[model samples]
Target chain A: MRKMEFAEAIESALKHAMTNDPDIFLMGEDVHTLRINLLAQFGKERVISTSISESAFLGAGVTAAMAGLRPIIEIMLIDFIGVAIDALLNHASKILTFSGGKWNVPLVVRTSCGGGYGDGGQHEQSLWGWLAHIPGLHVVVPSNPSDAGQLLLSAIESDHPVIYLEHKLLADYWLDYMGTGGRENVSFDVPEKGAIGEVPEKWESLPIGKANILREGDDITLISLGVSVHRCLEAANILSEDEISVEVLDLRWVSPLDKEAIITSVSKTKRVIVVDEDYMRFGLSGEIAAILAEENISPIQFGRVCTEHTIPFNRHLEDNVLPNVNRILALARKFKS
Target chain B: MTLMREKTILELYEAMYTSRYLEKIVTQLWEKGNIYGEMHLGIGEEAIIAGVLSHLIPGDAISTDHRSTPPFVMRGVDIESLLLEFLGHPKGLCSGLGGHMHLFCKELLLTSSGIVGSSGPSAVGFALATKYQKTKNIAVAFFGEGSMNQGMLLESLNLASSLNLPVLFICKDNNWAITTRSNEVTGGVLLDRVRGFGIEAREVDGSDCMAVWQAVETAIPRLRKRNPAPYFIQASCTHNEGHFLGDPLLRFHRSPKKELGAVTGPLTKSVLHYKGGRLDKRISSVSNVLALIAKARAQLSFSNDPIRRLEKTQTHLKDQFAQIKLKVEKKINSISERVLNLVQEEASL
Candidate 1:
């Protein structure tokens, strides 16, 4: 096992996957950041740096994947997905289904999401809920370094289109920038506990639809994913001090959604609090609540702590809008009471 | 002027005739209410499809717009499956889920979509795969001139040129986008627009299959090179059926006096309105409307039909033309009979 940062683990996964498969190629705008590492190692043929044309490049990646080549395309930011949604939503996601299962689009679209960087509205968005709502897409969001590396490999290997979202706060650049006395020496606060972990040296792909039980308890269950999962763990630890046990469930895959794990956890605790970084209305939290209601595993306490349906711009307002440890703890305490 | 072999010319003519006959049958079926939904037929674009696809081998890939039957038929996709798809059969291409607009043939490496300008990106992807595999196979995209204005298509042109991928973009400029004249919405010259991306651009008379064949034949060698670059061909053709089958413009042109009688009173009142503008300006506007209608009528002339043009050129081989027509017609008639029986079987079930 090797201890690596979130970014290093993702790079390790990509390097390993590309070295093993000759058909795998990476294309995106500004992917040349790995020029010395991936471009030099794989050559310009495999590591391509395209212009800022998302629809063209992403759609090209989709068709390339369909034509027997595995293409890993990076969309830079989730906010920019609107420009290329037709390729992902219309082509990549629906190609296999529309082709009567004759063609398979084994394409991976890696994009960064979440807010707190003060990068304005367009740059900061966690729209995984919107992506998961699409039928043929698999949405994977990993909180820790190990899961990030493993889930990405699984996504690359899957015979379907995968939307892999990385939280900007848990990214390597953010952590490295913060460590080096960030801009103006202002330390932007973010959850760092789940950013680094020990990844297995041997390449291993985690199943796409399984949730990890990060913390086991008999009290209320705290369900979340991506950066919010870290906050749930933090809240679980604080609640343990007050003799209140909280189970933290890290939902790794949002689309194939580990419903069995959710039902088991919610059934055991009989009280659940969903902490989501995405919007509150018609979002992940509502989907979870509906699942519970449909399963008739109700007559139990249920609560949610999610971001409002507003864009995050100002640093202070973003912090308030995004779910944090305080919000998880507040909801957990209310469920316990 | 590249001279094609007599055998090759016969093959191209046969393919074009087959497509024309098939689409004509499909139009009849649609008119008789056997086929549902809006049908976009490649009636006048057969010369372009046969000219480009005739040179393609099995491994070569093709991506096309909504009007894809001619290319699909010319590429050797199963005719029964295609006809069954038009009839909405479960065993049809794409299991009838994708109507005439969306068709897929895995063996031929062909795909079609109803979305506008999507063929460009799809062809780029196919060409990228060809480069990765280090093959001589090339990818082709067939779209209308209106699609040239789409951002994705322009972006695809830049990507293909920058990557030096083997992609041939064929723009069939039929002078119209549905009901609107393409020149009014499109800007500048299309050949110049494509040349701006540093790719070689050529134009050809789409009604002349020999001209289109020569253009593609010349481009194939450069595209099959080790370091291949993308190419563009702007083939100007006329859509005989306007945009789709039963287009109102075509209906208006069939009996101009009868169609105009219903609207002449209101049209004159609107054009000569006393409160709107000057009398001279209104009169000039009426003249412009009349000129557009006349142009539309002129485009539907039999001179633009590719089948007649090819037959006219092949007058010396009259016996060969007659033999080819009999074979194509016999094949199409059998296929049509089979499709009708299958529809009957399905209706009973």
Candidate 2:
């Protein structure tokens, strides 16, 4: 198995799609790093670096998509998405339906999200909930390198707009930098929990709206996504020593959510702990809680571990606000048989 | 001197006449309570629509702002469907989801947004696609002088320039943006500012259809070349009506009629007097100068009207222009009548 970083995997998926199709191009603000030498290789026409005007470029990306070109727009931070929300929410999301299915907005908006590494309130925020709320938008958050590569390909191939959120801390840059405390024994080249795998030579798109069961158990179901899924797995390992068997369900796609997996896992475990890195209110946590409540699933214990409503820039404060491994471990321990 | 071929000028006149007639009908509909919502009218600025659109061939795309009915009509968007859209019918372009403001016809490669400065970047995307696909199809982005100050529009200028995309940025400087004077709100010369981005820029009198056509004709060749760059044209025009229907106030800043009155003094004769000796030229006296001013203003307004702008120069083609106007007027009448019937049917149902 060949190891790959999370960002590398995403780049590989984009590079793979671009190599296969001449119509696909990348446009975004401050795309210098992700672009790397891709600009020199692909030429300026394809790997286009746009000015900081998000709405214009996003609108441009939408029009290009409508004109039979697949455009991937990179918003540096999910927080800055507010600037381009009009284009994303209005044009890209509804053009197909508005045009009576004549025009399909094949757009992929890749954005880095999450509150870690001291990027303040403006730079940090996992607003997948906001994107998920909008119809006609596919929200995908990959938990590991392999899924990141495959799911991005799916997003590119999607006939609708896909809001692909990448968590800051879970990316290979931070994983290689921070080493994730005590998980240092694990190989830093790939993610700690997931096995390292090579991207297929051809573009391989994973089915959207599917969940991955990273760790299987019958006692308690830990439902999470993105970076939170890795934290849940780490919590699962810590709870294993205490004889508390846990199931880790990674929700790969946020919208068209994997409700069947949630229902099946929660039915078997009879105890659930929903973990989300976004603000606890009106977000993924609330959505999961609503699903459980409506499903009439009989469980002895049900809890949710999520970040506090406020996201601070300070390292310690942001750490406390986010649902880290320690918080998930404590939450998982509370779910008794 | 003949500025263009009689057929070409007639085509431009027909497009302008269609726009003016349609806007007039829309204004009447809103007044009669048949149409709802904020409606922007392109009454006096039809020359820019005719001149710029005349340069576009089939396969070329255009993106426009809120005041976009002229382009929609000139681009040959189905009048029945567009009328239905205005009335919020299920079979409208956007299936009644978006009203007149969000008129988008993908088949014709035309898209509009109610938001200011929204269409500029979209035009860039269209240009980018044509360039990448080697389609040689140029895209035109039309916005008001007010939107020129918007950062997105400015960014679009830079993006189109650096990439050397085949795009034509047409800014209709109508002096008034809603109620504010564009000159007061906007800083720096519009042409100079765009030229700073290394884009070829031109400024022309928008009231003169011939001038606009000459400018667009000169600029379009560069855009059609193998390695084309973006072009910018700033057309000076007048917005004769309020920003929207029922806009209680009107700004007469730099009124075209007032200038025409100062230059022409009294209407000894008007071109509208041809065919029949109608509209007797009333001599002005010091006592009746205010009445003369009002009369002179009305005559000048009608004289400088886009349809009549070419009347003096193309006197030989007067009959041809009249025929074109009659045909357009007939089409607009038929379309509006059908729309009214549809609206009544919808109301009854």
Candidate 3:
């Protein structure tokens, strides 16, 4: 077992993914070790950087997808994704259906999200929800280092446009989520593909469209994703003794939603709750209820945990809205028996 | 030079004529209360689009302003979708959210945006990708003369020049940024401004669609240079119609200098010739298409459930929107009480 921080795990997984697939390349801000190391390990042709042109490169990534190359487009900050919405929404998200599925965008957009280090307004927003609403797009929010590595590899390998959300807070966080570096990666002079066995007895394919039940309970089904999922897990543990066994579902992939898991869980639990790190109105929770109703699941109790439009900072305040054990516990207590 | 084959020239003229017809129809639609929002028309400026897009090869990327329909139509945008878009139907190109300003054809990479100069840096981004990937695909950014002053446009020039990226910057110099003339926005010509940034720049008569096309086509070769900056083409033309149908024509008629009208007048002659149907059934053919679009638009407006049909087209889109919206907003749900406290307790961004 090797110790790996989120960034290093990402490095390890990226190195392996590139070695396995000759088409994966990196494009975004910053190019020292992350790109150079990949180029030296893979080849100059496989790793690269851009000149702060998010929209163009994202569009280029879409273009490359048409040529059968998988591209990893990076946004220096999650807030910067706004600059390339045209590429993401207009081009990448609709290329498949727009071309009637003749062109599949094998694209990966990696971005760092959340508030930290007093960066102020524009730099500190967690706008993953903005990306989630786009159709023909897949989204992943890796909670820790190991998951970051594995998910990044999977995203780069996948045939759809995937927005891999990495929390700014996890840049230093560590975990062991990798598998054996496949034979193709042996030439890349790198560490193993950082999969240190899936979390205890859990399976790790973590399909891009499935929602996993992190905690099983009889009272309420608490839905969440990314960093909030972990917070909900903590809340479930805290509220365990209120005779409220809150069922926690980690909606790992936001698009191509796993409605089956959500609907089935809500049917059994009856008390439905959602913790979204995006806006409330016209966001995921509302859409999930709308979907549940269409699926003939009537009387699904609805609740959401989301952020307001105000720029987030001051850890204490952000902690309140970004979903911590306290809020989830409170919601669990209020909604569950 | 406006030299071209007879058929090609006629096609170009026809496209421009169609744009003129479209502009008139849009104005009539707005006046008739069929259109929902404000729309910019390229009534007198059809040549800029018809000219530049005529020479665009496959895989050439281009960006446009709200007043950029003629070029897209010339470049093969589905007529059905184009009219539906103007009518604000779900069948419209952008599912109707884009309205008039947001028309985009992903396949052709023709984008229309309301945000001025925003596509500048984005054009640079595409050029960077193609250069890195070794693709021959070239991107074009079409903006108004006023956009020449936008910071991003300047930044894009530097970025493309520095990176030696392949991009064509086409300025549809309609001589007026609304009421103000081009001279007022920049000290010298827009082409000079682009060249000052070390980009290859040229000026063309925008009304001559064939000339505009030739200029851009010629510029593409220079963009292939190792140290190529973005090639800038200035299409000097006129906006025969007002900014939007809601805008008063009399205000513009009396606002600009009288000399401007004689030089940049509306295509009244073209429409006048059309009234005499026998002069050119070719003009009559365009009207026939317009009549069809008008009928489709009327049905689209009367239909209460077109959006429902659009939603059905993307059946999973709503749910998918919700799921991602949930992920994006999860923190907000947790933070509402905190935000309320902050407003009450701190009131800071």
Each prediction's Cα lDDT score? 0.81, 0.74, 0.62
RMSD of 2: 23.8
All candidates: TM-score: 0.53, 0.49, 0.48
TM-score of chain A of 3: 0.84
Cα lDDT of model 2 by residue, A1-337, tens digit:
5667677677667766776788888887434323533443354467665544577788888999988899999886787687579997888888888999898999999888875543344455798987898888899998877888899999999988999988766675433222221122333223364423455555589998999999999899999998788778888888889998899999999897999999999999988888887777788878887898899886547788887755543344556777888888776765563
lDDT of 1 by residue, B119-153 (tens): 99999999999999999999999999867766789
Instruction: Note the clash tally of each candidate.
Output: 0, 0, 35
Off by over 4 Å in 3: A1-3, A33-36, A173-206, B1-151, B155-349
* Selected candidate, larger TM-score, 1 vs 2: 1
lDDT of 3 by residue, A1-337 (tens): 5566566567667765665666777765433223333433443345454444567777888898779888888776677676578888888888889888787888888887764222233445666666778777888877655576767766876888998877654553211011011111111111222222232122123456766777788778888876677677767777776667888887777776788999888889888888876666777888888887888876767777777555332323434545556666666677755
What TM value does the first chain of each candidate achieve? 0.96, 0.90, 0.84
Candidate 1 on A1-337: residue-level lDDT in tens? 8888787688778777887888988887545432224553455567676544578789999999988999999887787787689997888888888899999899999888887654444456789999998889999999989998999999999999999998877885633221111122334556676678888988789987999999999989989999888888888889999999989999999989999999999999999998988888898999999999999997879999888856433344557778888888777777777
Where does model 2 exceed 4 Å of error? Answer: A173-203, B1-349
TM-score of decoy 1? 0.53
Residue-wise lDDT of candidate 3 within B205-314, one digit each (tens)?
Answer: 76565666678668766776565556888876655443454333222233436423532322233233322223344334334323332332221131222122223444
Best by TM-score: 1
Model 3 per-residue lDDT at B318: 63
For residue B41, model 2's alpha carbon misses the true position, in angstroms, by 49
